[model samples]
Target: MMTYQEAMDFINHIPHIGKRNGVNRVRPLLEKLGNPQQHLRFVHVAGTNGKGSTVAMTASVLRQAGLRVGMFISPYVEDFRERIQLDGQWISKEDLAEEVSTLAPLFRQLQQEDRAVTEFEFDTAMALHYFARKKCDMVVLEVGMGGKLDATNCIDAPDVSAIASISFDHTQYLGNTLAEIAGEKAGIIKMGSRVAIYPKEPEEAMEVIRKVCRQNSIQPNLPDLSQLEILSCGGEGSVIRYKGKQLHIPLLGEHQIYNALTVCAIFEELNAGGWDFDWETIQKGIGQARFEGRQEVICREPLCLVDGAHNPDGVDSLCRTIDRFFAGKQVTVVMGMLEDKDYAYGLSQLAQRASRFIAATPQDTPRALPAGKAAEIAKSYCQRVEAVDDPAQAAFLAKSQAGAEDVVIACGSLYMIGYAKQGFLREE
Candidate 1:
């Protein structure tokens, strides 16, 4: 058996098979593995943002209902194994190594045929195989990118296909317009699958989702946002009333409350289909849910926060959270971004409230925006700007610049935010 490190190396070193137009490559691989995904029930989730939080909330509720839940997410914040989880617990290194060893010969054969799977495809296959082997009651699978062609979409019609708040992020892969992006996300909504949608999505996106639902003969479930009332909200968390039931959401930001509402809509569809998880169970599950690197507070003494808000919509959400929780505080912002994202728009939004900006490049990504280039962009919006090549040093510098009461926030690519989180914790 391969050691965990060797397994990781093997998976990482695998060459990307040229991208296909559909799930054609992944389907064949899974078929060779006896179609492990066919034996599993899935709650397929897709969107530009909030999909990870939604998946966590859904899996948490399922676990609360006494089900062995599997969660599959991509672009892991801290650990690589965070991509595959069961009952909120990450998959063991032993299991990952064993699975890699078992799949090695097949992978080698595919390589020999020049049909090697990409890293994400391989990860999706491993997650499906692991979940099936463990006999999970349900799996909450988050799309790696667009839903229609994402490897995770290889699964058959899911039990519940949830489309979170749609926005523009992956313009090259998904589409440019909101309608087109929504169409991609709505691809997860298959015939005979109950659908749940985030209520606060743009009308154009909602129209696309509604049309897709109509095509599938499914009436999409949406939370009554008019009925959602925030009882209290701060850095710690928020308490909100939805559909006349008070629910405490532990995840920070108003956007997260909307995400929880999407989870509620999901549970509504599940209950309507006789899943039997009541509102109380959902509330408990939501209250217990915690996600890292999204408005995550790592240090309280210097008030340092890390958020993975790369796109315009996500940056808007992060700004709103900052205004709500740290209003009037002198904000020192540490920002990093990928080259392909709408970083200019994101930096412009943050600049409106930021007292100073430290630009850093996200680690481990070929697409990272250079610290100097990001700083140059920030200079147009803010008078105070500095380029820091290292994300951890940027976090430390942001904290050092802040006073006891000043707010220090690191926002940008999730890749950098993970390093920022580690650095911020060290400051504490």
Candidate 2:
């Protein structure tokens, strides 16, 4: 009887698969496990950013509507089991241990046959098996990477699929151009399933998605951003008028408005598909949804904010939020990112909104860019740049240097945000 942590460690050590865009490995692996994913309804979500937030909001709404829902998101911010949750509760430790132990024999068999799988694949299989055993009404599945071959794409057909804001991230794996990237995300749009996309999607990306919808005979619905009227935005939340009614969501940034719209469009598609729910349920669910790493405020007096905005588009949105909400206030940014990310552009954009900068690295990640490298890049765009290898220490330093009205923001990679969150949460 291994403990839950032991089970996760075992899964971690099974095999290392680079985020190579391929479903070849995961499909056969799931097939061997009896394809539990085949029996469940799915709302498959895929995007460079906002995938987790959109799925979280959708799951929250569905849960509020009184349905048993399962949720799967990746690169967990706080804990390992946080990635797979059912009805707002994480997979119980006992269940995780038991499930992993039961899967041990299969893992060995696969290894012996030279078919060892990645941790993401194994996690996806375990989540599907657990969900099937519990018989959830449906699952909001977030794609780990490019939609085409992501392990989560093993589901036979989704009830609905969503493509949130597509942007320039994962260029190493997804391609340089937006069209190439959108084409990859459009891979999740299987025939017969409805899909909703961001209203202001790049023209090239929209063309790619429209082509896929045409190929699949899916008349994909696009959320009309123009219909959304934002009434007010603050650290507390955003109020917007949609369909002539005010809706409030307790999340930060204007970009989240579009994410909400994407969810609303999905709800409409689901309603059309015979899932009985209404706008009130959608509002309650969205308002209740809370994501840990994006615009999560851990402190109040001397504000400390953390966000998982490591790319150009994400950084741009964060900057907009800071400008809109924290105007006339000095802000110090503590940042870290993966070496492969477009940190030059990301850091420069962040520099525009920041009064000072502290560079740090996401502890323990193989892809973490060195803090010294980030400091060097910040030097080009910022007058005040300091390097700290430890993310927690960087956060503390920012807090110590801040005034009562000044803010401390930690942004870059989710792992970096996670590490800072652990440090801050520990103090509270």
Candidate 3:
């Protein structure tokens, strides 16, 4: 048996199947493990952005209704254990080690198949097995990349499959166009599943979703966007009125409001499907739901906010939120990005709202765009752009120049935000 740290090392080193292409390996791997995903109820969410917040809110609502919930997210904000949780608590290190030890041999055998089992596949299988053993009432599963080939899609079917706001992302694996990306996301809509969609999704995306629903015979569950009214929004978050009831979500950005709307639709769909969670519980869940790395406010004195806005759509949302919340304040951004993302568009979007920009490379990612390259591109968009060695140094240099009221925003990749948060954590 391996220690917890060793088990983590084993899992981390597992190779991916062609950089997020297909889940052929995960299917057989799960089958060998008795297909634990089939034994549990799930709410599967896939999209370019907001999937994390949507999954978190959905899990919180289910928990608020007094049910034991399991959550599995990808590219964890800080810790690997954050990827798998039972009722808000992370999987214990002992449990992770045990699960890994039990599956390690099977995972090795999976390599003999036509395609090798990737890290994501092994992680998905382990999470499902643990969730089944724990007898979770529901599991909120977030698709790691494109839905069609994502390992999480190994589930037979979900009680509710939701597509958060789909946009241009992972263009290489998913397609170049919006509809193509939507089609990949729509792959999560399977047989015997209820579908929920972001009310404001692009027409191209919604058309693809509608077609998938038609083929699967699942009724399209759409949120009534008109009923959602944002009464107040600021650095803390937003208070929105849905129908006649008001709810507050601590996650910043209007994109999160749309995500909450998608959650509301799922709650209604699940209630009609016999879950029966009340409005108060749903409101409470949305309020209590906590997700880091999406406009996370780390320090009030320096007014530091870290957002994982790696893609164009996400950057646009982050910039809009920053503009709304800190309209007249000086904003200095510490940015980083992956090589494959639309960094030019993302950087340009954030640059529109930034008074000063410090570019850095996201820590520990082979795909990271170099700090100098990002800084070079950012200079064309923003007047003041400088390259820093790393996210920690970029944050320090950015903060050094900012006054008390100026907001030090870190926007780019999740890894960048993760590194920036690490600096704050070390202080504590």
Which has the greatest TM-score?
1
> What TM-score, computed on C-alpha atoms, does each candidate reach?
0.97, 0.96, 0.96
lDDT of 2 by residue, 328-400 (tens): 8989999998888888888888876778998999876798999998888888888888999989888887887
Q: State model 2's lDDT.
A: 0.87
CA shift of 321, model 1, Å:
1.4
Per-model clash counts, in order, read 0, 0, 0
Instruction: Quantify all predictions' global Cα lDDT against the true fold.
Output: 0.88, 0.87, 0.86
Question: What is candidate 2's CA lDDT for residue 109?
Answer: 83
lDDT of 3 by residue, 121-212 (tens): 78889999999999998999999998998888888878899999988887877888999999999999998888889889999888899999
What local lDDT score does residue 278 receive in model 2, on the 0 to 100 scale? 85
Q: Over 4 Å off in model 2, which ranges?
A: 18-21, 426-428
Summing lDDT over every window of 10 consecutive residues in candidate 3, give the lowest-scoring window.
Answer: 16-25
lDDT score, candidate 1, position 189: 87
Candidate 1: stretches off by over 4 Å: 20-22
Rank by TM-score, descending? 1, 2, 3
